[model samples]
Target: MRFALVGTGLMAQEHIRNLALMPGNIVAALVDPEPASLAWARRSLAESFGPATAEIPDFADVPSMLAAVEADAVIVASPNFTHHDVLLLLLATDLHILCEKPLCATIADAEDVVARSGGRRGIFWVGMEYRFMPPVTRFIEDVHAGQVGTLHRLALHEHRFPFLPKVGDWNRFNRNTGGTMVEKCCHFFDLMRAIVRAEPVSVFCSGAADVNHRDERYDGQVPDIIDNSFTIVDFDNGVRAMLDLCMFAEGSEEQESLVAIGDRAKLEVGIPSGIKTLSPRVPLGAPKAVTREHVAVGDDVLAAGHHHGATYFQLRAFLDAAEGRAPVQVAARDGLIAVAMGAAAEISAREKRVVGMREIRA
Candidate 1:
């Protein structure tokens, strides 16, 4: 299938590299208003695939690309604020759309997309790379397969460096990127929902822009995005999930740590480490039955993109869905709920109160 990328930014460049690994998909046209980003993408495509890929058509915007080129699918890696409008045009056509996470920068816009995209011929998938991570994928599978029998609690931690610089520093502002919770943590929120297999009921988050971006100023305005926070989500199935996020901890070895505790045993996994540990219940005086193993991903796959080659895995599944071989794993509704959960976390952080999922939906 041929693919057209709407925004030629860092994420789009990652998609280009991952597509090179796939070998079946062709990037027909690249679209971006920023000349620098477009030029960078051309170089990246050539470097990722070959010199021939640099000859792909380029356009300043989606409409111009749509008018000049034909593509089987389109991936929206544009800025957070532009997703709604870009999707509005793409959804009108029959193009299979793979929209990057945080569906929209606002709940209202996400709701509109969910409402409008009731039934479409082409596939509509929300890009969620976390669920496709190999070690995390194995962890989730073990948890679901009764390794962590009767699961009740889950803890997810992401201690990593601050957000990378975007094209125009758009990520520093909440108004443009839907706050840190929605913009960045939406991936975690979606992961929680997928693993818990239930809708979120309430969220209580304590967060602040306490560390990063303190001295940085864009037009004399300090960045309001969160650098550290703790968000607790209460799922309808009585499962309690917590997210511990620290954007200022670049020295941390593992960027992500996930733990699931249940009645029979406990499961733990760490990203980049790619190690999964399982400890079954043991009597007070019995020997520990802890087991450790690694889920290996090829070096070539790992080199494709970040998230431990998740983009490549996700793209393969997405193409399968596009070709009528499987259902859309992450639908618009899932993306909307994930956005709502993130919004709830943001509101809870600012208001110093628990925000109900119903409140956001209502």
Candidate 2:
């Protein structure tokens, strides 16, 4: 399948690398506004893929690329704030799309994109790659297989260093990247939605720009994005999720940890490692069972360079769905919900109150 890639930044580079790994899939066109970035992408592609990359075309804008290229689909890896406009433009072409997370910067934009993309022939897949990670996928499977029956609560915690500097530092501002929660936590939010198997009804969040990137200034403007946040999401089916994020905590043994507690069992999955399970005994005075399972994610996936080997799987799944070889896994609604959850969390934190999903949707 022929594809057109939007943006030529770091994320786009990762997508390009994965695209190179896919058989018969070619990047027909590259779209970027900056000439220097486009040239750099061309050089980078040639360096990475050798002579075959020479045949790829470059365009300054999406319209020209859409008008000239005969691509089977488009991969939208552009900036977060530009997602709405880029997606709307791409949807008009009736080609399948694989967009990066936080589908849009705000709820209204997400709603608009979701509305417009509906009933279209193209498959709209979002880059919520965490769901495809080997360990994560296995954990979810175990949950559905009754290992964890009727999940009551789930907590996703991230203790990592401050945000990496982007190509343009657009991520440091809320107006550009839709705040830190939407920009960084959408992956976890999407996973929470899938694990709980329900819609998020309300959210209560508390966060602040306590540290990291505070002393930095761009164009005389200090970064306004929060460095730490604690969010609580109440699902409609009585399942609750909590997200604890601390960007200032660096050099942690595990970058992320997820814990799910249900009536049947309690499971803990450590990022970049394996899963641990503990189940209560049914009979009175019976001993509980403990188990630990390690996961081998494969070196090929690791080389793909995003989300610990999930990006390759995500792209492969997207290509298969686009070609009608497989069902679409992550729909536009899923992406919208993730973005909405982030937006609602931001609102909740700002207002110091519980924000209902209805308010976000409205």
Candidate 3:
């Protein structure tokens, strides 16, 4: 399958590398306003493309790319703020779309995309690749299979370094990147929804731009994106989920961890470690029955990108669905919900109060 990559920046380069790992998939066209970004993409493309495939066409905009290239699908890896506009150009066509997360930076735009993409002939999948991580995937499966029987609580923690520099430093601000919560934590919210098997009811988040980028200024503007946060979400299914995010913990052993507890068992998973643990309920002072197993992901797969091979797995699954082999796993509605949940968190953090999901929906 041939794919046109819109916005040839960091995530787009990741997509290129992951797609290059696929057997017959090729990145046919590149679209971005920044020539430097386009050049970065070209360098990455050189890693796999041969002589005949050397001269991949590049475009300054999506329209020109659409006019020049014939592709099986398009991957929209553009900056967060450009999603709604970029999608407007592509939504007019029948090509399958794999839009990167948050759906949109705001609820209104997300709802618009979901409504417009509903009845299209081609599949519309969002890039919620966290769902495809090997350990997380196993964790989710185990939770759903009753390992964490009658689920009640979930806690997801991400302790990592600060956001990387982006093209034009577009990611350092709330307006451009959806205030870190919608931009970064949408994945967690989406994962929370998936594990809880329900929509969120209310969100309360206490966060601030506590660290990272404090000494930096772009065009005389201080970065306002939050660097650390703890958000609690109440789900309709009676599950309570919390996200503990800290962007300054570069030395942390596990970059991410997830815990789910229920009446019957407790399940936990850690990334990088790829360790999954299950501990069922036991009577007090009795022998504990617990299991800890490492979920193995191939070294080459892990080398493809930072997502722990999720991009490659998600792309392959997307290819399968595009070729009529499977159904779209993450739809536009899922993206919308995730974005809404993030918006709720952002609002709650900013206002110092709980934000109801209905308020966001309305």
Q: Give the top-scoring candidate (lDDT).
A: 1
Which pairs clash in the backbone of model 1?
A: none
TM-score of each: 0.99, 0.95, 0.98
lDDT (0-100) at residue 142 of candidate 3? Answer: 94
Cα lDDT, model 2, residue 319: 80
Q: Candidate 3, which segments miss by more than 4 Å at Cα?
A: none
| Cα lDDT listed for each candidate | 0.92, 0.86, 0.91
Please state every model's RMSD to the true fold in angstroms.
Answer: 0.8, 1.7, 0.9
For residues 1-362, could you state the per-residue lDDT of candidate 3 as single tens digits? 88999999999888988887888888889999999999898888887565555689999999998888898899999998999999988999999999999799888999999989977787999999899998999999999999878999999999999999988888998888778999999999999988889989999999999879999988888899999999999998889999999999999999999999999999999998999999999999999999999999998888889999899889999999999999999999999999998888899999999999998796
Q: Provide backbone clash counts, one per model.
A: 0, 0, 0
Better of 2 and 3 by lDDT: 3
Off by over 4 Å in 2: 276-288
